[model samples]
Target: MSAKIQSSNKKGLFTKFLDVIEVVGNKLPHPVTLFAIFSLAVVIISAMAAAAGTTVDFDRVDMATGETELTTVVAISLLTAEGIRRIFSEAVTNFTGFAPLGTVLVAMLGVGVAEGTGLVQAALRKLVLATPKKLITAVVIFAGIMSNVASDAGYVVLVPLGALIFLSFGRHPLAGLAAAFAGVSGGFSANLIVGTIDPLLGGISQQAAQMYSPGYTVDPTANWYFMIVSTFVITIIGTIITEKIVEPRLGAYTGGEKASIEKVSDHETKGLKWAGISLLGLLLVMLALTLPANAVLRSDSGSLMSGSAFMAGLVPIIALFFLVPGIAYGMAAGTVKSDKDIAGFMGKAMSTMGGYLVLAFVASQFVAYFNWSNLGTILAVKGADVLQATGMTGIPMLIGFILVSGFINLFIGSASAKWAIMAPIFVPMLMRLGYSPEFTQIAYRIGDSTTNIISPLMSYFAVIIAFAQKYDKKTGIGTLISTMIPYSLVFLAAWIILFVAWFALGLPLGPGAYIRL
Candidate 1:
């Protein structure tokens, strides 16, 4: 009895800690406002650093000449007359030229159509419903991971479906919800296919990488290979946690309502079949364009993956990859009756991105100013020097970076927003330490993803709590975080181990992306 009381007290303290985190996180400013503030702060700091004559010298490789030269970066004050004029002149271009803005918008145009047409939702339901009862946990988790392809569809669709499916099987509904949440949120960075986040983060990393190497390009597929492997690893781990830990801990379902799993309607099934056919047809067309040595999509060197027309047009290709199948799905399902419907869907998608547009505008100015001031370059060099001086190079330093990223994730829920701010510092810093931007980006992603489930600041966290309350009236922030903490802890450990093993084996993070420069 005494021991039980002691354990209860410990749990109570842990709950209170999470409650504090929620309060603090909630009190923070909106992400867009935060970026605006960051932009202003950068302007002020640039002036201060310039006044103080802060500078750094580093060896820069001349891309055109293939020669290394010592380059000195002196902080430029944004408050100066020339700086103020440049900022005013470049403001419009900063927003327009931002890499992530166009790529994410283009990609979402297609995803929005697919999602708007109900194809993504139907596909997720079909995947989870088709799995055998014994393998349902793994399937639910896998479905959640794959649902990232359609943005927030997993949170809105699969999460609650997971609960209903579990209740249908006479299992605890919360266990299924936990499993889905684990995959949707905790395993966010792990997906078999490239998603909107891939390009969004890649663009940010590329922008940051350019601070160190002018011609360096980080492709959307930079972390594709690692993410594909992580997908299976997370699935297995999530399944194990769901079955061996979370489910058992919940004991049994005592909820009032009995719910059955919703089966896909006939039209949706037919739509999926047509969508699959269209997808295959699209693949065949792509193969025809890239298979031959003299193919139109091939590079001058006859490479398809590197410096090729196909590689350069990847964003449009990805857009079409979804657009074609989505159109087909919609037609067969009667969700789309005319070309006007497709246009309307696309417009609706862009309309929903108003908040993102505002955030991107401010963020781009911040990035441009940081670059213009030479602050990012100087910081990278100084940071690298300090790390090298301390001899913290290699796996230990990488692990520490990941931990810091995870800790920051608790307060800031937007992955792209956080990366935009962090990449300018960490990407170039890691590059100076002899790591590739791709490696740094993937490391950041791992940390960012692992802590998402327990973060109250996550955009979908409130939605999750609302979902939980349907089953348990007492479900609150503490209860949800406590349930998810096990998944978060296990995923962080397992993912870091995987990252270390990958590093040790000298594996390619993605096509043409290596561990070192």
Candidate 2:
């Protein structure tokens, strides 16, 4: 009785804490407004910094001479007459020139088609249903992780389907929901294929990196190798937590209603077969283009990974990878009757990007203002000096950064938005400490992905709670967070361990992306 009372008291306190978090999160300004405010603040700060004669000196590699040269950066006040005119003139170009804007829009166009044709959803359903009952949990979790390829489809389809699958199997429905939710939200950054996020985050990182190394480029595949490895690691860890911890805690399901698991129809199966064949053909064609010593896709030095034509054209290639398969599936499944249908599907995909486009506009201005002021460079140099002074220049510092990223995630939901605000500061600062921007990005992702499931501020958290309430009416924010906290904690630990091991072994984070400069 005493133990039960203690548990209840603890639950009550946690509930209150979450209530406070939700309240505080609600009071924050919209991300676009926040960026607008940040841009104004940057302008004002630049003036003050310039008046104070703030400057920092650092050694920069001179690309022309291939020699390290001492460089001094001084704050350029945006309040100057020239600065104000430049800002007014550059406003239109800033939005147009933002790196992430075009890349994300292009990638989503293809993803939207695949999603519109029901190919992604059918594939997810097929994977979950085809797995043997004993291995169903792992398959559901894996499917959810991969479903990120189509954005929010995993949350809308797989979360509820997981509940039905478990309930049909005489297991706890809530456990299934938790498992799928863990994979989709908590494992957001781990994927076998490059998703839209790769380009979005990479572009932001590249912009940040250029604040220090003017010509440096961070590719969309910067974190690909680490992400591929993390996919399997998260799958195995997620499966263990679901079966051993989440399921046992949920116990037997005494829910009133029983629903049948939906099986894929004959047309969907035909669509899958055609999609697979098209994808295989696409891969073979790519191999033919890339495998030869004098291949067209190779770089000037015959390298496939660096400065290659293939790397430069990767965004369109990814689009074709999805578009071709999507069209094949659509035709096979009778979802596409004409070329007009395909056009409509693509247009539909682009339509959802209205919010992102608005957010990107403000964010671009903020970044542009920061770069013009030279404040980012000064701050990075000062931050690196401070870290060097304190002797926290290695793994410990990286871990601390991950923790800070995760903590920040609780207040901001959009990954790109948080990264936009952070990349300018953290990316350059960590780069000064001898860490590559790619490595800093990987650390940030690990933190961002792990905390997503537990954050009330996550855009999809309310949606997950709604899905849960269908299974158990009493389900709320606290209930969902309680169930998901285990996955969050375990994933964070496992990823940090993986990161430490990867660091110790000196493995590359991705193609041409190393741990140090």
- Model 2, which residues run further than 4 Å from truth? 62-66
For candidate 1, what is the lDDT? 0.92
- Note the residue pairs that clash in candidate 1: none
Quote model 2's TM-score: 0.98
Model 2, residue 27: distance off in Å is 0.8
Kindly list the per-residue Cα lDDT of model 2 for residues 1-517, writing each as its tens digit.
9999999999899999999889999999999999999999999999999999999999885534556778899999999999999899999999999999989888887888898899988988888787899999888888888888777789998999988888888899999999999989998999998888888899999999999888788888998899899999999999999999999989888879697977899999999999999999999999999999889999989999878999887888888888999999999999999999899999998888889999999999999999999989989999999999999989999999999999889889999999999999988899888788999999999999999999999998999899889889999988899999999999999999999999999999988899888
lDDT at position 439, candidate 2: 97
Model 1 spans > 4 angstroms off? 63-66
Instruction: Summing lDDT over every window of 10 consecutive residues in candidate 2, give the lowest-scoring window.
Output: 60-69
Q: Which prediction has the highest lDDT against the true structure? A: 1
Model 1 lDDT tens row, 1-517: 9999999999989978888888898898998889889889989999999999999988886645657788888999999999999999999999999999999999988988998899998998888778899999999999999889777889999999899888888899999999999989898999998888999999999999999889888888999999999999999999999999899989988879688766899999999999999999999999999999999999999998878998788888888988999999999999999999999999999999998999999999999998999889989999999999999989999999999999989999999999999999999998888899999998999999999999988999999999989999999888898899999999999999999999999999998899998
